[model samples]
Target: MGIRLCIGSVNPSKVRGVVSAFQSYFPVSDVRAVKVETGLPPQPIGLDVIVRGAELRARLAMSGDCDFSTGVEAGFYRFGSTYFDVEAAYVVSRELGESLGFSPSFPVPPWFVDEILSGRFRELEEIVDSLYKTENIGEKTGFISLLTRHVVVRSELSRLATLMALTKILNRELYEKGALR
Candidate 1:
């Protein structure tokens, strides 16, 4: 039987990214996006919180129904006086193996970061949608693409992060030998 892949998000971009990344390694039999709560603020503002949030979602989304589960989260990182956009990815297996990966960060507007940190903005996605008068831009290029002029898209970034997070499973021996346990 082909592999069954599940992602802990309903966002079409995230689901597609996960599926695409795993497809290179396996012939996926079934791919599904399950909505799961990430017990974190809507707009997580730090590296630790963002990674933890994704791990939580991946672990929770296993639900014993899929061979592999993945979680993808996008957040901002504060370094000195600048805030950069980051993508965090987590993958889990029902057998208790897991891995984490991150994508490159790009600088965001200082004022926008200030507004978010000050709690004046609910979330980055909302800000992007409101400012550009766009609806659900996230499933496509997203705010990053608009800012970068499509040099990269959210789905592309997510796919790369997902691939990195699968390293443990890709090696197989590391996990099978109980090195991670």
Candidate 2:
């Protein structure tokens, strides 16, 4: 039977990234997507929170019978007066292994950071939508795309992170204890 690789999120960019990563790593695998709650804020903040969200989703989504599963989560991080975007991915396998991977970060507009830090608005997507005059852009190009000038899209970042997580799964000898930590 072909490996059934499931994704814990149905966001278009996430779906594309997970599917692409699995296809590239194991061409014969069957990839599928499902909407899973990360148990995090609608829009998470801080790197740790985002990574935990991905790991939680991956663990929950992989509970059923499946060869592999993954979850990708993105969030904004603040340092001093600067804010940036980051992504994390978690992958779980039936062999009782899991791993985490991170995406390259890009700085967010200072003004937007100011608004978010002001505590009036917590969801970055809403702010982005209002400023860009768009509707739910997070599922499409994503802030990553906009910030990077499309040099690398959201899917690309997610895919890179997925590939990184897959490393521990594929190389069990290097990580016998566990990967998801």
What TM-score would you give candidate 2 relative to the actual structure? 0.87
The collision pairs in model 2 are 98-179, 98-180
Residue by residue across 69-170, what tens digits does model 2's lDDT show? 898988877787777787788998877488998888788888776777687567788898888887777788787767768777888888888888888777
TM-scores for candidates 1 onward, in order:
0.91, 0.87
Model 2 worst lDDT window (10 residues): 172-181
Report the lDDT tens digits of candidate 1 across residue range 1-181.
8888888898998888889999988889998788898779988889999998889878777776798999999888989988988889999987647899887788988877777778887788877888899888887778889988988889888898899988876886776767686
TM for candidate 1 is 0.91
Candidate 1 residue pairs in clash (backbone atoms < 3 Å): none
lDDT of 1: 0.85
Off by over 4 Å in 1: 172-181
